[model samples]
Target: MKLHAADILVIFWLGFLTVSTVKGSVASQIAPRSSCVDLSTQQLDIRNLAKYEMQHIPVKAVMFITRRGIKICVQPDLKWVQNAIKFLDKRPVTRRPTTKPKSKPKPKPKGN
Candidate 1:
């Protein structure tokens, strides 16, 4: 039996939809979830912190990322949290050193 052009087009469209749906679910699962459910009141050393991000979903807090790749959630209005933010902002930016090209020496003058 011969398949009509319309039938082939319909099959292609259904396959495309199924693939996109599966891809969307996988992507959502792989995405990082940053909502803060619990917050800590302990004071953290500003030196150990690498940076911070404000978390507004599920709770209002500050998420401090440590140099060791740990995330600490703290209340935004806390004195220590505010101080840590200021300290991080004032810290100098670190940059990688760039190599410079070597200059060639000029040719010696020929004997007269």
Candidate 2:
């Protein structure tokens, strides 16, 4: 079988293109999902303020754009709200009372 120089060049270019495309897709998949989240410095600052001041503040919802560029907002979990509330309502925990009265047990009856 005779392999033409042009055929080899074409095969090399095609392989290179295919490899690059696959690498690009795999790299994108491995990248952190939050890297695309549009959390601005101002927004993050505002969120921090609300988190500190309010027991349950609704901050920006997380969103993702699909390959077709459709935006989808993910609902925050109920536990996240609870956590926020707990955080805001947290008070300094005090130490428990150290001294407790010891209970005395009755002596067992003598065996017959």
Residue 50 of model 2 has an lDDT of 26
- The TM-score between candidate 1 and the true structure equals 0.62
lDDT of 2: 0.49
Global Cα RMSD, each model: 4.0, 15.0
The sequence of per-residue lDDT tens digits that candidate 1 reaches over residues 9-55 is 99999999999999999888865577688999899999899999998
* Model 2: how far residue 92 lies from native, Å: 20
Cα-based lDDT for every prediction: 0.92, 0.49
Cα deviation at 22, candidate 2, in Å, is 0.8
Clashes per model (N, Cα, C within 3 A) = 0, 0
lDDT of 2 by residue, 14-101 (tens): 9999999999998888543432233322222112422332112234454434335544333334455445446545735557789988
Clashing pairs in 1: none
List residue ranges in candidate 1 displaced over 4 A. Answer: 1-30, 99-112
